[model samples]
Target: MNDIPEPNNESDSSAPIHEARLWRDDGWTARVIKNEDDDGWAVEMIKDGEAEPALVGPWTMGRDKKNPKPLDTGAFNTLVKTASEVLRRHEQQLHALLHKSIAVTTDSGTINVVLDIVPDEDDPYAMLSATDEFGDAIAEVRVAPTFKLTRASAEAWIESGYRKPR
Candidate 1:
């Protein structure tokens, strides 16, 4: 019986269940199931409170060849580690895309600039801001999400008396 019911976000999630081919613990569930692509098996690692699995990959065959390797503490731990790393990398990439920062020295002082983007479905936008060396906000303005922030642009903005970039 591979038909394990998944818990929804609003309900009581994060339950722990340990079975032969299905194991749930530590905010993740590991399930070994038949691979739809081939006669081999596949394992999926789903984080608790999430409907979709975070990681899915081929599984090793057991001694019987026809059977899938059962879930164990060691295997489950490895899967959790891998899936966690995958999520971490994805988050890092997203942060890199949504946020940018640059620092430069001018006659006034060192200015730290940052661009934060909001990827709204209906109204995407970004906020371009700058702070002095003492972490005092110098300027902040809303800009198009497509705004490109660079050292030259920062210098130009500073030279323009912190006016909205054209």
Candidate 2:
């Protein structure tokens, strides 16, 4: 689903309605929308500056059993925490997929080894690079994205003068 645009904060008079169906706060917005499949309500939690909701789940019905329960401070705080954690985990996973690094000690000195992957549907590949303690680039080579980067393999590559892996 596409992210909803952030509401403008400059004009309080222009703020959207804060009924039980929808509400907004400093860093998050909570909306209780109807479930199309059944006679129930679903709540969506969206973070600021994000286009899509971080979470969507079932919501409780009001005492009248005809409307959704109103969003309060306690519930809003819990939703914010849950949504923030979801975003954090997603970012970490993406970083792991795109970049990896390790440290290895050779006869000369310890070098920082890095592998960055370029994910393309037709031509996926990875770049293997090394840097000295002073952050000077020592070598770089392109290899398959699934290439295994081990200490022995990296040492061998360095010994071979950064030859392209076959």
Best by lDDT: 1
The superposed Cα distance between candidate 1 and the true structure at residue 44, in angstroms, equals 0.8
lDDT of 2 at 33: 79
Q: Which ten residues in a row have the lowest lDDT in candidate 2?
A: 1-10
* Local distance difference test, candidate 1: 0.89
Going through the candidates in the order shown, the clash numbers are 0, 2
Q: Which runs in model 2 stand beyond 4 Å of their true positions?
A: 1-17, 35-39, 48-51, 120-124
Expressed as tens digits, the lDDT of each residue in 7-89 for candidate 1 is 44474556676777788889898988789899899999998778788899999999999888788899999999999999999
TM-score of each: 0.90, 0.73
lDDT per residue for candidate 2 within 94-125, as digits (tens), equals: 89988988888877898988989989999999
Estimate every model's Cα lDDT from 0 to 1.
Answer: 0.89, 0.80
Q: Residue 151 CA error for candidate 2 (Å)?
A: 3.2
